[model samples]
Target: MTRLSHSKHNSLDEKDYIETLSQKRNTSKSRKVLEVKSAALAAAKQHGLNPWSKDSLILYMCCFTSFLCSCANGYDSSVMTAINIMPFYQTRFTSGVVGSTTGIIFSVYTIGGLTSPWIAGPITDRFGRRRGMLIGAIVICIGSAVISSSNTKGQFISGRFILGFGVSILTCAAPSYIVEVSPPQWRGRMTGLYNCGYFGGSIPAAAITLGTQKIKSDLSWRLPLIFQCVPAFVVICIVWFMPESPRWLLANKHDEEAHAFITRYHGGGDPSHPVVELEWHDFKEGIATDGADKRWYDYSELYKTTSSRWRFLMVVFMSIFGQFSGNGLGYFNTQIYAAVGYSNYKQFVLNLCSSIVSCIGALCGVAVADRLPRRTVLIAGTFASAVFLAINGALSARWASMPSDAKNLSVGQGAVAAYFLFNIVYSFAYTPLQAVYPVECLQTNARAKGMAMYGVIVNVFGFINQFAGPIALKNIQYNYVFIFVGWDCIETIIWYFFAVETMGKTLEELDEVFTSSYPPRAQIRKVVAIKDDGHVDLVKEA
Candidate 1:
């Protein structure tokens, strides 16, 4: 293991950096901070370290353990969707999975999610990211066991609550670990891929349920519940061997370990690599020893500064918008298909097909995540989703009223097609960004707590969505779709006005953008670096 050297030149650089920050703090007027080329990206390019390189591959494998957190979450969602459609499950449960009873069953999971953030934030910050993940995985396995063997409504709901609690912990810790460990050059795609793992779990769960729906007994639903633990178990087995976040190590005073991890994984075993040096400087500057993460109870740092508040606002926005967008309908997609006159067999098949389409859409999002501007994707994709949702609602309103024998096959098929299209667009837009954007907006000191806050807001809205979706669908029928249609339009406007571009900048570099008088404008400023003197100038364009 190699250690970073504190030479005189580096000392002078640190002094200059601190003084610059102090000056920025004292000044009331806005000024342009020097924005250099991303040193990590430049270093990787200079060293010719491709994605397939030994070091890069190893880093990706380590990151894969975190991806399982998302997989577990995805499996739970898709499996529940399948279970809701199963006649056996409906028969076994006391309430029979309809109306208000259905709402409670779905909402209990998010209710458990609401309880996790208090402990999740502290655990991830205090015990380290790997520990948080491991604990969550173990809890998920326990929850799965409880749910699979459940004999009554209370037992089933308790199991779901436990599952939600465990998933929340993983959600809080895993993204923070991925963003901190990933090199800036690959950060977008890597973190995007983290959420993309949702489809990895969804595909299997959907497929399994499709096959299991043929079973004549309780095992049809119980078997799917049991399978939910597989990804969590995989995470438990492998997470211990993965490297700790370098940012976390440095913040915790494990400086040598931080350096060695960065060297071996990010710098390709070259301690003196520019990526390592730059990363060390940035992590030191960005992470505070006495920041909110170090304190067990103080959350003030998340809202203390204008930048911090802006970051919090973005986190809140993504959390609410991500859940409220008609994707919540996914959990009850079987109900939606039934409303449009699809048979039970057809509903399960469509559910499976929808999961496959969503998986493909998520992969497409991953491919373009690094290439496209974040703001562009959010606005356009959201609007497109709203359009498709409106079409689905219109079709359902027309065709859902007729008797099953009198239903128009073409109109019913169109409604299903529109619903599928809506999922594809939603997956393409929000799926990749949901995990990536929130973490990118947050500073390292506030990351764990902010993400915990994110978990709270997500579950809060998710609870509403899960609890109300069935009731609304039952009473208002197709009218439930317009609520999301209207909200999604509002979401598009919010993203247009407030969303800051994070493309092509290092996490430390984002500090400048967020702290500026107007972050959206600051994000649009073109930064040009002078190779001769290693100085950079920000040219205002937008």
Candidate 2:
């Protein structure tokens, strides 16, 4: 990674890289989750989902099932955001006059998210993507029902933990399922569409609670808890008919099913299609197994080889940098507005508008994620965010140094605008793209485990920011932006050295990039492969 120190951003070269590749390469498409999980949650399931349809409805529906599962994730993530605001929610049921047990109520979800991956990895890998999603949806459904029906604080807390557990498991399987099933050309937009649902769940969760805030029964908050199951069960029913991931089927030795899936979906019902045959050959050559012990705990394999090790660390670091990039601040930006001398009304408007902007960014990502190189989106996103934070910090610092009379001055307005723009840019790039890079970078065999690790790392960072963001806000005031600015710049450096372009390649073709020793910047479109019926070898691009 030290290679980053010598890295240079030659703008002309990047412009050429984007242009030449656009002209030369076959086109393709490309988050795992929301602000936290949105980018990951949208997609479908049913037995070959919509098998009777002559169009690609089956594939789209199957992926859409995953998106439905994400609604559970989004709902759960935002449920508390609204619940905490409702006086009825805070004053009811528990022995303390409320489930004011903060640790048990709040941290329990994070605990479930942190640990579920260990179980999720093997389940998704061994049983199949669809099966794993079913299990997650069922767990979340039960959790939602339990939560809505709970008569005591402990029961609600237990239910929260259970729902969190299920959401974590789906996060691992859903993104992997979407990637495995999607075609190379339209992958980005489809995945980005799922992210839209992530925000979709959240906005409604808040709205539903706010709408019922004055309702005098337990129904006020309980119904929202129960409603979380709507999307979860929707996914479960749909996924029942959807086809399992073609990649998972191939890796698990269901070669016939794998072959047929590509024929039906990727090639429009033609088994002899060139795309179908080439993809199979790529899978065959790329996944040559070493016959190692296939235990569930065999994740040590993630770091056993040099390329796998670098890629694993790369994914982990990206998660870390993203968290440190001050997304939590966006999540809790009302405090930011308060600190900057904005009224509560103004804060509410900004938050509402930012939500709309986030949706816009998700749509943009869908449009260009497939068109632009992955590395370009990542570096540009991080740098732009860092720049925004720096400007925000400057404004806040200026306001802080001025007399109290100057507190609500125009500098406060500038800080608000800068941060809002930051929110918009993040959704377009960092938030949605997070899911694409990891699944694309890893090989098929390790993808489930890799995604599981992705969850753990994200939660670990979330835990830190969860604790740190508030502390920085209270004690250090506006200067806290400097931490993220420095942190994001370092992250940009790491990405510059590690990000290889995965655009336009099949999941199998991505193997050609990571397995090579090429420096990061030159990895794409340079050391190309020519597979003559499963003999995979690289030749320099002429």
Candidate 3:
């Protein structure tokens, strides 16, 4: 009995010692986590900034030029709504084939869109971001001049294609450039500002098209197309005034340039301070672990791993979802109005109202995107858009089968209301998603490549959406388009399930968040440390 008691005591002592050691280990981990959290918060706070800072203001000014450049995107999509109803395009360009020619004119731009990302992404990564912007601006200006001078359909198509190439480069380059150079706290807001400029561009484009409907000159349609060149010219002139992406410079091993840029924007700072070194360390470590110079951007990398595969799939679907939301289909709203027995002048006025609502929606989205979690805003906006589209479809179905007498006043009102409501919601969601989500989910090394792939998917779907709009209208009634779009509510459900919230995450944090749930999660780790002077350093565990 004495021996047994002695053995039990020894066992209990062993258990106690083991428990104490476990507690110490856990305590150490907890302390480290706390330290990391505090450091990250301090650094973010230290680097916090306003969107109107001198550098940011310059970016915003460039955004305005980009905004004007973006008008061509909206104009290319929607200009045909009015032009199709015009006598010139109908009789001359289409050979009286309004539907087919209209689709061709709109869809041809996607040809350039498909090729632009591949060319732009690698080049932007190699050359400076400003150079890409400058080239795109110059090309677009030349294309616009060509557009203004074109008399034949072939010439018009070629000019539009060239213009699209320029727009694609600008679209892919500008936001990423803005986000990369911006302070983390204000990155979303600045990118949002870029989006706001884009929609603002649309408002004037639509207004000009409506304003010109009264003119009898051949310039009526051509002038709007030519007017797109104005922004390109502005962008070219402003390109010299803008700062290049500091992050891109760092990535290119331009350490001196990168430090100068960060100091210029971050206030009084020693360029070689510990904080700056920390930031550089974090950036370099992230690139090394995340796979830069990895087979020189192999396309197979997208599908080789589960995480990458999922990312590619998500971005592709997101791009397709954005296009399929039926916002672009509204480009053919004039046809819908005409089919409903409305006159051209009335449709023009109606489109202008829709444009105004879209602008308001885009601005609201820019405001809310920064305020709310990105995924939530996107989901809510998509849901709202789906609801509006459903209502429009119901209204269309009701009117399509209604007697001629009841259709006159009520159908027009319903159509206009549906168009207005949908634009407002879609714009709010679209403008930000286009800017924030892609940039947020990606890190710097793969950011350009990831976004390049995203751009490709967007243009692919955009091409299909633009091409299908006319065929769908020709084969079926106008109501079918809204019905098709309303079905995208299903996508809202998909988005909620798969989408990650990214409202206020740092670039490094975002990189971690993306890998958070992947297999071997413990194998992939993120380490970010900030020195007292506000330089940030990060490392990723392999």
In TM-score terms, which candidate is top? 1
**Backbone N/Cα/C clashes per model:** 0, 41, 4
* Shift in Å, residue 1, candidate 3: 53
Error of 3 at 467 (Å): 1.3
Off by over 4 Å in 2: 1-53, 92-105, 149-154, 214-220, 288-294, 341-349, 397-410, 524-541
Total clashes for model 2: 41
Model 2 quality (TM-score): 0.81
Evaluate residue 134 in candidate 1 and report its C-alpha lDDT on the 0 to 100 scale: 93
The ten-residue window of minimal lDDT in model 3 covers 1-10
Which window of ten consecutive residues has the lowest lDDT sum in model 1? Answer: 1-10
lDDT of 3 at 281: 39
Tens digit per residue, CA lDDT, model 1, 288-334: 87777888798986899899899899899999989999999988888
lDDT of 3 by residue, 335-393 (tens): 76766667878888877777777888887777766567666777787888888777777
Candidates 1 and 2 compared by TM-score, better number: 1
Error of 1 at 428 (Å): 0.8
Candidate 1 runs further than 4 Å off? 1-40, 401-405, 524-542
The residue ranges of model 3 lying beyond 4 angstroms of the native Cα positions read 1-42, 46-53, 62-69, 95-98, 267-279, 288-297, 300-305, 482-486, 518-542
